[model samples]
Target chain A: MDSNGFRPEHRFDVELVAVTKRYGGTVAVDGVSLRIPRATYCCLLGPSGCGKTSTLRMIAGHEVISEGDVLIHDVNVTDLPPVQRGTAMMFQSYALFPHLNCLDNVAFSLKARGVPKPERHRRARDYLARVHLQDYAERLPGQLSGGQQQRVALARALITEPRILLLDEPLSALDPFLRGQVREELKRLQRELGITFIHVTHSQDEAMALADLMVIMEAGRIRQAGPPREIFERPADAFVARFIGGHNILRDGAGTIAVRADRCRLGIPEAGPHIRGRVAAVEYQGSSVRVALAVDGGPPLSVVMPDDRFFAGPVQPGEEAALTWSTRDAHALPDPA
Target chain B: MIGGGARSRDPREKRPWTFYALATLMGVFLLFLYGPMFVIYLLSFQGPNGGVTFPMVGVSTVWFEDILKPGQMANIPVAFGRSILLAAIVSTITVLVSVAAGLGFRRRFRGSGILFYLAVASLVMPSLLVGFGIGLGFQLFGWKADLFSSALAAQLTWTLPFGLFAMFAVFNRFNRAYEEAATDLGANAWQRLRWVTLPILLPGILGVAMGAFTLSYDEYARTTLVAGNRNTLPLEIYALISSSTSPTLFAIGTLTTTVSFLVIGATLAFVFRLQRRRALARHG
Candidate 1:
C-alpha cells in the first residue's frame, strides 16, 4: 500500500459519512463526518470518553455500526469486517500475543491468511528492521522492553501492509523517556512508509507534533478539523481554539477572537487605545517565558516571549506590559454557530 | 514454557514453606482416609503361602499371566481403550460445544444471562444426579447401551459442564484489544478466532481435556448403572473390590493410578506455568 508522498494537487479523499454510534442509551459518536488525505497523518484529539476511541474502533470495524459509511478508496465498507476493511490498528496495550516471538507476532496475520512461512518471515523481518528491532526477532513479547514491544506491534501491523493505520494512544503505555523516543520513531515510520495514519490521542503536543490533518472533538462532535497549524491559528469555534493550543478566547457580537499568546507581543504600545494589562504572573517554561497580563482592552491576555534574552532575568510580577497582535493572528471563530 | 513472572521477589512467597508442611500433613491424613492401596501393591507379589516373606521365595509371574488371559486380561485393555476412546470423543465434543457456548455467553444478548445461569447450573449440579438423570433418560428412550456408550454418557455429564466453565475462566482476562487490533489489521471473524482466540484458549483447553479424561475414566457409580452388559475397567475393579480381595484388582489399580497421577501432575504443571506467565503480566 506504499505510495508516493502527497502530491499537493491530490486530496487524501478518505471519508466518514454521518457516523453515529449509540451504545444502548449512550450516544458515543454523534454523527461525525471527516475526510482525511490519502497519505496525510490525521489525528483525533480529545479528552477521555469524548468518542475518540469509539470513532477509531468504528473505523476499524471492531464496533458494529449503528449508522454511517466508512468509505476507503471510495468503497462504502459499512458492512465489511475489520480484516476486509484494509486497515490496521496499533492498540494502546500493543496486544502482542505472548506466546509468539517478535518475528512470529509480526507474521501472524500473514500466517492466518495462509501466507507461506518463508515469505512471511522475510517480509516480517524487513518490517522489524524498519523499527530497528531486527536483532530481537526471536524474542517473545514478554522479553522486550515497553518501547521495543510497541515497535514489534508496529512491525506486526505494518507487515500486513494495510491501506490505513490506526494508532490508539499507542505511546500511552511507555514511560516518559521511551514515549518521546517511540513518538519520534512512529513519526519517522509514518513518513518513511508514506501510509495514511489516523492517530487518536488526548495529548495536545502529540497531535501538534505529528498531525498533518487533525480533528479536535468535544463531547462526541467534531469541534474542528484542519491542518494542525490552521487549526491552531484559525479554530472554527471556541472549543477548537481552546483545545488545539490554549487560546485567550474573547467574546464579541459576531464571534470570539482566539489569539495565541506567543503571537501577542508585550510592549509599551499605545497604552489603553490598543491592549493594556498589568502583569499578573510570569513563568519561564524552558524555551518560552509566559507572561500572564490582565488586558483592559479585552479579556486578560497571556503573552509569550520567545525572545528569551529579554525575559531571561527576573521580571517583577506587578510590572505593566501592554500586549499587541496583528489582526491576522487574532482570528474570529463564530461561537458554535 | 514458563516466563519471568513465574518467580517472585515478594516476601510472601517464602510463606509457602509453612504451607508445604501443612500440605504434607494433609497428604498423610488423606493416606489414612483412603486405606492401603499402597499396602495392596506391596502384598501383590506375595508367594504361594499367601504372605510376603523377605527371602525371595522364587518370584512368580503367575499374577501377571493370570490377568493377561483373553477373557480377563483382554478385558482391562478393552476397557482402557474404551475409556480413552470415550474420553476423547467426549473431550472433543465438550471443547467444541463449550467454546461456542462460552463465546456466546461472553458476547451477551437478551437471554444470555439465563443462558449463563443454565451453564452454571450444569456445573453446580451433583454428579450423582446428572448420572442418574442421563441414565434414566437413556432408559426411557429404550437405548440399551453397552460399556462404551455408558462411559460416553457418563463422561458427558461431567465433561460438558467442565468444558464450559474452564473456558469461561480462561476468558476472564481476555483482552478485547487483540480482536480489535486483528480486525483493524483486516482479519475476519474466522481469522480472528483461529489466530487470536484459539491461541489464547489453548492451555486452558489442554487442562480441561486431561480433567475430562480422568473424570470419565475414574467414574464408578455412573458407569455401573448405564453399563448394562459392558464391563469397563472401573466397573470390573469395583465389582472385584466388593466381591473379594484379588491381586488382579491391585494390578489394575496400579495401572489406572499411574495414569491418573501422570495426567494430574502434568495438568498441575501446565497450570503453574500459565499462572507464572499471568503473574509477570500483572507487574508488567
Candidate 2:
C-alpha cells in the first residue's frame, strides 16, 4: 500500500497492452504498449505524426483502438467510453467553452453529473482559486490570455478527479517564457494530487523538463522509453539521439555510438584516437560555442566547448580540427531494424 | 481633397481619385436599388381619389384601412395568415435540417459530393422550373397540391441550399477541439451538441431563419405553379394588381414591406444583443 493508503492493485494507474489505432488503411499507432506508474509524470515525446498523440488519445478513449486492450488501475477499460475510463484530457488548443465563463467551464463535468448549482459553483470556485484564476471566474475564455486559458483547462480537467490525466501538447501553444512557468505549475499540481499524468509533446526540452518517464516515439512506434537523464545519456537508437538533440551520433568501427557534444575535446591531430575534419561553421551560444566539422568519409559532426575555453584556442570556419571523446563517454546505440 | 495627378506622393498621404469614383458609384447604386421602394412608400399614403402612379391630392389612411376589408376579388387577411404560417414552418424545418446536414457534411461520406452538387443545382435552377416539376409530379401521383404541401416543397428547394451553404461557412469556422473537450469533460453526445455546438452556432441559425422567412414571405413565381385553390399573400397582391389600379396596391406593398422590416429588424436586434453580450463577457 502507498503512503496515501491507496491499494496495491491501483499502483500503475494506466497501462496499454499492445494497443493499436488504425484509420481505414493507415496505421497511426502500431502495436504500442506503455505503463504509467501512479503519481508520476510520463511524457510521450516524438516528432509530428509519430503516433504520440494517437497513443495518448487511445489511452483517454478519445480514439478507438483497432487492437489490444487498455487497463486503467487494473480494470479493463478498452471498451469503455472516455468518461467511463476514469481519465480526463486537456486538449492542445485549451478548448475552453467560449459561451460559458471560466467557472462554468470548470464546473461543466459536475453539472453534467447533475451536481446542484450552489455546490458545483463552490467546487468550481475552489478549483479556480487553486489555479490562481478566481478573479476571472465570470470572464469568458477569450478574455483570458493564452496562458490563463491553459490554467482554466487544467483546472477543468482536474475537477473531474480522474485516476489519470492526459495532456496533449499542453505547452505547445504557450510562449517560451510562459511555457516554463506552466511546466512548473503542472509538476506542482501532479505532485500535490498524486495522480498519474500522461502528457504528449513533440518538444524535447518540454519532455526532458517535466517527465519522470520520457518515451521517445518514431513513425508510430516507441524508439525508447526511460528516465530523461538515462535516455539523454544513452539513447536506444540513432533516432532518439538525433531527436533529443545535443548528441553526436557516429558510425565507429565497433558500431553506432552517441557522444555528448559537450563531452568531446577539440585539439590538434595527435589528441588521442581522434577523427580529423575541417570546421564548417562556428556558433557562439552565450555559454558555449558549437563548432560544426565536416569529415571526408562521414556526416557532419559538432563539439561544444565553454566560451572561455573556446576563446583560448578557437577554430575558425574552414579550418581543420581533430575531434576526440573519452572512451567512457561514448554510449553504444542499438542498430535500427 | 488631395492634389490631382500626384503619382509621386506617398499613397497613404493622398486620397486616390479612384476612391471618390468608387464612393459616388456606390451611392448611385444604393439609390437605384431603393428608389422604387421609396416611391411605393410615399404613394401608399396617397388620398382615396389619387391614382397609383401619381401626384397625391391629400394624405390619408383610407388605403391602409382598405387592406383590412375583405374585397370582392380576394380576401387579404386569410392569405396573409397562410403566408405567415407557411414561412414559420419553413424556417423551423430549414434550421433543423440544415444544421444536421451541415454537421454530416463535415465527415466525408461516400455520396456527399454528389449530394452537395445536387443541392447547388437546385439552388441555381430557375424557381419556375422547380415549382412546375413538383406540381407535375404531384398531379401524376394523384395528389392535390396545397400551400403547405406543394408550395412549401418549392420554397424548400430554394431555401435549403442557401441554409446549407451558410451553415457550411459557419461550421468551417467552428473548432472541433470544443467538441472533443466536451467529451473529455464527461458530456455525452447530446449534451455536447446542446451545450457546446448549438450555443456557439445560434447566431448562424438565426441568420438562416431570417433568410428563410423573408424568402418564403415574398415568393410568388414558385408558389404560383403549385398553389392549387387558395392564394398566398403575394398571389393575392398579384390578383389585386390585375383587378384594380389605385393607391390600395401601394398600401398593400407598403404594409408587406413594414412586416418584413419588423421581423428582420427584431431578428437582427436579438443577434446584436447576443454578440454584444459575448464582447462584454470578454472585456469584463
Best by TM-score: 2
lDDT by candidate, in order shown: 0.76, 0.89
TM-score of each: 0.77, 0.89
TM-score of chain A of each: 0.87, 0.95
Quote the positional error of residue A88 for candidate 2 in Å.
0.4
Per prediction, fnat is 0.40, 0.54
**lDDT tens readout by residue for model 2, A1-337:** 5553435677578888998889999998999988888788999999999999999999988888999999988778899889888899999888888788999999999988989999999999999999999999998886788889899999999999988999999998888999999999899889999889999999999999999999999889998999999999988888899999998887677888899999998886563557889999999999999999899988788999999999999889988888988778889988666
**Which residue pairs show collisions in model 2?**
none
In candidate 2, what are the lDDT values of residues B1-284, reduced to their tens digit? 12344668565797879989999999999999999999999999998788787788799898889877666534887889899999999998999999999999999999999999998899889889989999999999999999999999999999899999999998997889889889888899999999999998888899999999989998988999999898899999898888888888888889989999999999999988776556523212
Best by lDDT: 2
Off by over 4 Å in 2: A1-8, A294-298, A335-337, B1-32, B42-74, B110-121, B137-144, B279-284
Q: Give residue B131's lDDT in candidate 1 (0 to 100).
A: 68
Q: Model 2, A239: alpha-carbon shift in Å? A: 0.9
Instruction: Single out the weakest 10-residue window by summed lDDT for candidate 1 chain B.
Output: B275-284
Q: Could you tell me how far off, in angstroms, the CA of residue A281 lies in candidate 1 after the best superposition? A: 9.6
